[model samples]
Target: MMPQLRTLTMMRGTRARILRKICRNCPNLTTLQLHGCQKMNYSLLKYIFEKCPKIEKLIIANNLLADRQYAELVSRLEHLQSLEVFENRRGAGPVVLRFLAATCSKLREINLSCDYHPLEDVEYFVKAKRDTLTSATVRWTMAGKRPGCLPLLQKLDLPHATDLPDDAVVTISRGCPPLRHLSLTFATSLTDGALAEIHRLKHLQILDLSGCSGLGGSAVAHVAQLAALCTLLLQYIDDLTELQPSLRHVLDLKQLRCLDILYSGHIRAVAFEEFSVRLVNLRELHVTYEEEDEVFYKNVFAEMQSQMPRLRIINTFRWTENDFLTDYETDDDDDTDIGY
Candidate 1:
């Protein structure tokens, strides 16, 4: 029942061999997201470039696409509009950015998470006039250094991430005037002061301030004032306990639909229940670390499913029949204890 298709993409878990077969057939397809494809090799990627000549978007998140492999792929597929090299540890963020900037002039979005040193080269590309460039995400976890790719972005995401500082946030607000989605998770250095600066993005839709254990209730209060925010992720914020109390200052964000409070450690079951009652329009909500409170998760899930009947998938597990967990499950499951 799918619509007349021009694209097919896969995420979570997709075998490389099957993907290669698909690539050979779908030459006219324009987008491909091969995330968590562990068996992905260089030959398959090259085959994609050779067969799928119309591909304009490619995403390889949390997958293994080495620097040389990426360079080779980029060199072959010159018609890409969006290129993502997520969670790569070989090169610096700037180095990868510069490489993409050099190869793909039509790139509209790039999400790079790398651990390389020195970001000056990447910064240069950000300043370049690429009219199509709109969405970007850059993360670097090295110590005693600041990455500069954030300042020149229009849309930014660093959800629950550690290591970036307050000055970097300020620089981003000052430089990237069109920023609409900002995530400042695990940024222990941030304070209430940082939120005030980035409030100028009138088009802002998504905001994440999870894992920022340093900020107090005031920071959450400040973010609630963002008029255009629709999605908010507030996981691991040790300071803010009760949602109604901490986020009481701005309780009238009627446009809000999604909220994530995973591993916050401070959220009480009662507070969560009360908060959900107020969110009449919420379509998606996630709160983890409540396994002991199975009743809470079940109730929340029930409420979510009832309110947002359009939900298609919900996955939370240590191991399942899914191929990604096949190896782990095979190694750990106690088969001898099973009477069946």
Candidate 2:
């Protein structure tokens, strides 16, 4: 009689009979991670819930669950403390979202993707229990789509927050003192002056200021001061043929694992060489193929490969003149349609 299992991870193609037997055998599982399980349905879920009443975390990523079954699952696991909903095909709609927000009194973190009505759902969840939440990720549901309105989140992740010439940046910085992760990709009106506000968020571990046009290659110095920064995404940030010392401040981050400064913004051959040498723990570096200027990217990539053999590169450079235009917005959001 083996029991007291606190965490269980079942791989894909895990048969229902075996899954049920496992659940029955170890009834104390608090964290169940069974992504890519095509056979997942109400019966298996019901058995799991019945056997594992103490479950506090559930991850059903990349799995297909019927629309109606979500509520049943939630109802069975009102005691859940963490949940992952959007990594699958059929997403849980507002009804289910609202139900979870209301019922899951112990919920401290949730990973959700929103294409439409992005702001409303997030606001509801946060407002429902302000003190309970410690982490939240409003991942962009579709790559083609951009994030819309967002609440005054400790971790603000708006695809586009209206960064007017002045008040917007101040408001953004002031709103999120508790911010740990901020992704303001393609943000409008962000200027060099705004760095003062952003730099104050020292708690930030992940910062994505990629595709920002208004910044115009001016804020990396302040960013380097963030002691907790780990992953920095700066794709197509500005026009630069070589890496300046100001920009090279990124090398200061001791914990940085992933750096995506593609589009060859001021990063020259020597700078790239220095970058490869400095980052001991670097795992991924994304850069564009400077076909026109073979001296820049081609040489840099060759040197990087030689220096760091274990690093991964996402070479889908596909850069165009339009890349200089960082304004990532479309009028499609005016309709306020919710993705169901």
lDDT of 2 by residue, 149-188 (tens): 2233456565654443434555556556667787777764
RMSD of 1: 7.2
Write the residue-wise lDDT of candidate 1 on 249-322 in tens digits: 43456667777766565345324444445655666666554345667567766765665565422324222234
lDDT for predicted candidate 2 compared with the true structure: 0.65
Off by over 4 Å in 2: 1-15, 26-28, 33-43, 61-72, 75-79, 87-95, 116-119, 139-172, 188-194, 236-258, 263-266, 273-286, 291-340
**Backbone clash count, each prediction separately:** 1, 3
Give the C-alpha miss distance for residue 251 in model 1, angstroms. 1.2
User: Per-prediction TM-score, please?
Assistant: 0.68, 0.64
Question: Stretches of candidate 1 above 4 Å error?
Answer: 1-21, 33-47, 60-73, 86-97, 116-118, 129-131, 140-154, 159-161, 242-246, 268-279, 288-340
- Pairs with backbone N, CA or C atoms under 3 Å apart (clashes), candidate 2: 240-266, 242-266, 243-266
lDDT of each: 0.61, 0.65
Q: Quote the positional error of residue 286 for candidate 1 in Å.
A: 2.6
- How big is the positional error of residue 121 in model 1, measured in Å on the Cα after superposition? 3.3
